[model samples]
Target: MHPTDSRSLAGNVAQLEAGRQITVAREDGFEALKALLPPPSRRALVLIDPSYEIKSDYAKVTACLRDCLQRFATGTYAVWYPVIPRPEAHDLPRRLKTLANQSGKPWLHATLAIGQAPDRTTPGEPAPRPGLLASGMFVFNPPHTLKAALAPALVQMEAILGRGRGQGHQLEAGG
Candidate 1:
């Protein structure tokens, strides 16, 4: 799992009870991830944290996803980015939509958000500023039962992240 924040990664490790066999990549460099996995692990779940703010870097991500899809059963990709006021962020989901629409295999995507943006300053040492608050996922060849599992998990994740900032929607290929 690739996470931008140490706090979030630590929380996930504890909540998921990831075993001792797990390897934690404290740095953001993805090469470590590729090297850790075998040449053809087949399927995987990829999480891209808010670190991918530069759209140009998406080329590497897109290529990696394509290669994984061709060689694996399915690829689950989770992308997290702040809801910035620009087309770049919005365009990302659109491009992913185009990929799913053109692909023959089963696919799914979803967008999640917390509450509205929060003011920069507040009383009592200031509340944690609500981030632009957006996340998205693309699942290739997703299992039919994914909705049931993903929905509840997301709800719980939102709660742990904070309050009043829970919202999400899913898109499926050929739906």
Candidate 2:
């Protein structure tokens, strides 16, 4: 996991336990990912979960993913992004799919919304839901079994986690 903030990455009043191996890097993750991209023939899974707190992170995520595909088009890149009311959030999935298409790769995109985006009455009105109500993951060059496997799981997640009328899950894929 590429955590942007050291504090969140270090947080442990509870002392987290881990089964899988982990290596901590203090530098920027995007630059690190660029340096690590293997050849197009190599098979690897890259999970990119950025905070998206900064406006530039939206642009950076796509740029970095595009750069990675250029280096390793066959690699599986799983990018997790928040689903907020912001235009950037809404546009990201579309951007990712375009990149995958350009690289001649398949992608599976899934979203899980636990809360609804509240109705806005006026243009200047602040969102009733301040934080993220939904989030999504776009997987480029996903495994053949992934879509079939995740479909049922997402349905279960929507049933279990849904809280409002618009709260649900969606899965879309393309080559």
Candidate 3:
């Protein structure tokens, strides 16, 4: 619930819902996360869903996950990223995998594509193109039953959406 933009609006909305449960911080989520980690936390589910407005967000996400792992090796971490043509989006899953490997923990990656693949003619094009074709979530220290639970659901969603060519769901996991 740590939203960096439109701080007052976000904080107000959070307060209306569950003021005590949600701490709406007007700061970078990575920094907020750092302050909340380590000694005090016994077990945690850290979800890092940053707006990739800047390419540096990708690297920051990776770096934050790496540092978090060092502090809380057993914490369950989930990262959500768009599935676009950008190199950062494409490489995120691999980077997350590398982090999971370093910690010797299992991770699960799931992607859902609601439409056809985006055009890639322009290699250096900026992201957040006209259409949002796909999105993905990478989960470190995933629950054992997550894959089995998500597979059929994603398949059903793809079928319902009438997925186009090269448009479908993907689930991958490893230790």
Q: What TM-score goes with each of the models?
A: 0.59, 0.78, 0.79
Summing lDDT over every window of 10 consecutive residues in candidate 1, give the lowest-scoring window.
166-175
User: What is the RMSD, in Å, between candidate 3 and the native fold over all Cα?
Assistant: 5.5
Residue 87 in model 3: lDDT: 98
Report the CA-based lDDT of candidate 2 relative to the real structure: 0.83
Please, what is the whole-model Cα lDDT of each candidate in the order they appear? Answer: 0.58, 0.83, 0.84
lDDT of 3 at 109: 94
Tell me the lDDT of model 3 at 115: 79
Please give, for residues 1-175, the per-residue lDDT of candidate 3 as tens digits.
3345567766577768556544555668898888888645477778798889899999999999989988888888999999888999899989889988987999999998887644565668675544777899999999899999999999998888744776788999999
- Off-target runs (Cα >4 Å) in candidate 3 are 1-22, 39-41, 117-130
lDDT per residue (tens digit) for residues 1-175 in model 1: 3445666866677666543444556764445555644435554566655356567655555555555445543556555544556667667666655665565656666656665544566577857755566667766566778866777777676666543534544434433
TM-score order of candidates, top first: 3, 2, 1
The weakest ten consecutive residues by lDDT in model 3 span 17-26
Q: What TM value does model 3 have?
A: 0.79
| Model 2: pairs clashing at backbone N, Cα or C within 3 Å | none
